[model samples]
Target: MPTATPSPDFVAALREYQPLVRRVCRLYCQDADDRQDLFQEIVLQLWRAWPRYVPQPDAKLSTWLYRIALNVAISNLRQRTRRPARVGLDDDAARSLAQPTESSAYEPEEMAALYAAINRLSDVDKAFVLLYLEDRPYDEMADILGITQNNVRVKMHRVQERLRRLLVPASTH
Candidate 1:
């Protein structure tokens, strides 16, 4: 099938915001293959939805970009059954992650533990965690989830508590 060439504006918008989509994909899909598939799906959905994108006078483009990317990443359910039984971390990737780079915030083992807990969260909770981790404003988080701002604040607090519970050692709790 011949692929429709993206409009110049579409091309520019996509190129400028791909990293945002990639980050969402990485958060949602642990397997590299699933990550690439989700990335492609997000791009396809964005391309299909481009005609409706009205550039408001004062709105930030990244906000709209995040909305669409999160929508796609959160809604996709077809690949759940196809997920591999075990996803192995590449040795080189693990080695690089362990190395203390200039910007390293946590040890790789801590990061791995964090990811393990995150993976165990429910899908909705995972969405909440993603937004919280990104430090999205309450209003924006509410808009993304179609909830009130107060509700978002409440839910955000609950989500954090849940994550804390998950991360706390069983013996300490």
Candidate 2:
């Protein structure tokens, strides 16, 4: 019997894919500790599935990795039980987790408000927001989410409207 060595390309692929999981986890998890844990979980899942990754000529490797990472992050059942203490803006601990932006206009409060609104959204809607914020095209977003582009547009519009309504004070309602 002949033994085959693991390819170096697999190691490189894992390294390249790590950031996608990290970013998605950061968006989904509000606290540093929870985000780190989620990242670890996602990586573990990815590593487990890596050997079975057969490449298709038509599809990009990054997209395939992204789908797996997003699926793992979005459908993670463990998150329900181990909810992060610093969810959205209310928790004082959330401040430290904010990513720095080059522009001065970036405000943690606004991000907190957005996240607070997002928390009220359904899981599917949260995926829409995450993809939208990542600047993905409607076609790609639709493909990743398993919906038509038109439906994605319509749902995205509704999601934004709902988020806006959530941000408004009760007095305005």
Candidate 3:
């Protein structure tokens, strides 16, 4: 079957939102190859769904993009089987991992530990974390997650507590 081409508006929107999509992929995918695959799958799904999207005056485009990306990532993660552990990072990846971002408040090691903790979270919890980290308003997050604002608030507080427990060493408790 011939594939439908993405509309010009869709293409433009995708290009504009690519970074947000990539961030979602990174949060869900540990491996570079897996991230790439997830990114492609998200783009494909976005293109397929674009025709159905109706822009509401009060709705933000980022919220819509995030909802679709998170859904795709969560679905993809569930469908994937475990692969053999990666032996080592490539030179570039190693360097990147070792180097902390200049603007980041945390050291490289601290950031790595934080990411490791995040990776341990359940998919739904991870979605909560991602939305919170993005500084999304409660209303937008509730809409994206298809929950009430009160639920979003309750879940977010729980997620924060869980993350704190994960990050704190038992020896220190």
Candidate 4:
């Protein structure tokens, strides 16, 4: 059977949402090459699923995007072989974690450590962290994760506690 081409509307939507897709890629992937591969795979899956997409008045586009992106990332993570754990930072790592000029939140080292801790989380926990960092509503997070809102709330709290343990100083603990 011949394959269906993606519609123009789908193409336009993907273009507009590409940054969101890339952000998902960044959250899940460590290396630049891996990030690119994940990005391409996500776009492929999104294109394949585009025909089935039905716009609902109550649903936001980002909800669908998050669902697809997280599912693909988790699946990809499962399929990959494990690599040696990395320790210490390099120039590339520092560059990637660089903060915007307008922001004076966490220092670069703190940001890198936070990201490293996030990377250590299970795929499901990482999804919770990603949605929380994005400031997604519990309802939308539950919908994207296909869990009850209360479950999302519970999981999110646990994930926050885990991150605190990972990022906080021992003296503060």
Candidate 5:
């Protein structure tokens, strides 16, 4: 059996926006192996779907990528028999996260705690978090998520509130 070679165009595009894909994997898979598996799955799905992709002025590449990545991650989560507890960031996952343009916003411990809390969120909420963290604008997020910009804003607020509650120590609550 032989495998079809991926086109140069697909390769180049994926290489460019891989961090977006990695962000999705990091949010969904805590284990290194699981992350790797999910990444491969996403690439495979993207490649298979490549020919069907019709680039349009209104449809940003990132938006299409997010839809696929989030769908794969959510579907992968559903197929998991055991959802791994996210205690800390794996080194690779940490390295792959989209960094702040300026100084680091959170301390290392704070970031780890934040990720753990994010892991506790439902799959849909997790999608919201991933997009928000990627610094995606509300309009782009709405397009990616197939919702109105207003809905994206509302969901983002609720997701943020959930994270705040999750981060608070039980004793503090």
Candidate 6:
């Protein structure tokens, strides 16, 4: 069957929110290749869903995008973990990994530490972190996450505390 061409509106939305998708991928995937693959998967999923996406005035486009991206990332992670883990990468791959995927929000060292801590989090908590980092409003986060606003607030607090403990050294605590 012939594929439907993407609508101009879908193209526009993807262009505008491409960074958001990258951010989601960065938060979820540690490997450079995995990040890129996840990004492509996200874009494909977004394109496939675009026709059914009716923008509700109350729910922003980014929220819907987040919902799809996070679901894909979490599902992908689950599938990946079921397989045997890969060993160390080649020198070139390591060098590529050493480079920042995107302009980081924190300093290099701080970003490294923060990402390390975040890596330890559950996928759901990582979603919370992504939304928090994006400066999304709680209502929007809840909407994107398909949870109650109060659940979002509570989970966010717990996730923050978890991240804080993860970041703090035992000697300093």
Listed per candidate, the RMSD to the true structure in angstroms reads 3.3, 3.6, 3.0, 2.6, 3.6, 3.2
At residue 16, what lDDT does model 6 achieve?
97
Model 4 — TM-score against the truth? 0.87
What's the TM-score of each model vs. the native? 0.82, 0.79, 0.88, 0.87, 0.86, 0.87
Mind giving the per-residue lDDT tens digits that candidate 2 earns over 24-106? 88667666676788787776766667678788876667766768777887777346547645434546544554444676366
For model 4, the superposed segments whose C-alpha errors exceed 4 Å read: 1-5, 82-91, 99-104, 170-173
Where does candidate 4 clash, by residue pair? none
In terms of lDDT, model 1 sits at: 0.75
For candidate 4, the per-residue lDDT at 14 reads 94
Kindly report which residue stretches of model 2 are placed more than 4 angstroms away from their true locations once superposed. 1-7, 77-79, 82-90, 97-99
> Per-residue lDDT of 1-173 in model 4, one digit per residue for the tens?
11477778888999999988987888887777888999999999988888788898988988999999999999988777465544434567655855544654777777788887887788999999989988899999999999999999999999999998888877885
Better of 1 and 4 by lDDT: 4
Clashing pairs in 3: none
Instruction: List the global CA lDDT of all models.
Output: 0.75, 0.73, 0.85, 0.85, 0.85, 0.85
lDDT of 5 by residue, 1-173 (tens): 11399889899999999989988988998877889999999999999888888899887888899999999999998888466555556665554443333677776667777887898899999999988878889999998888999999999999999999999989986
**Following a full C-alpha superposition, what root-mean-square deviation does model 1 have from the true structure?**
3.3
Kindly indicate the candidate among 1 and 2 with the higher TM-score: 1
Off by over 4 Å in 6: 86-106
Q: Among all windows of ten consecutive residues in candidate 1, which has the lowest summed lDDT?
A: 88-97
Which stretches in model 5 have alpha-carbon errors above 4 Å?
Answer: 1-3, 82-103
Error of 3 at 55 (Å): 0.4
List candidate 1 segments past 4 Å from native: 1-3, 78-102
Q: Write the per-residue lDDT of candidate 3 for residues 13-122, one digit (tens) a residue.
A: 99999988988988887778888999999998888788788999999988899999999999998877454554334445444544676778888767676777787789
Selected candidate, larger lDDT, 1 vs 2: 1
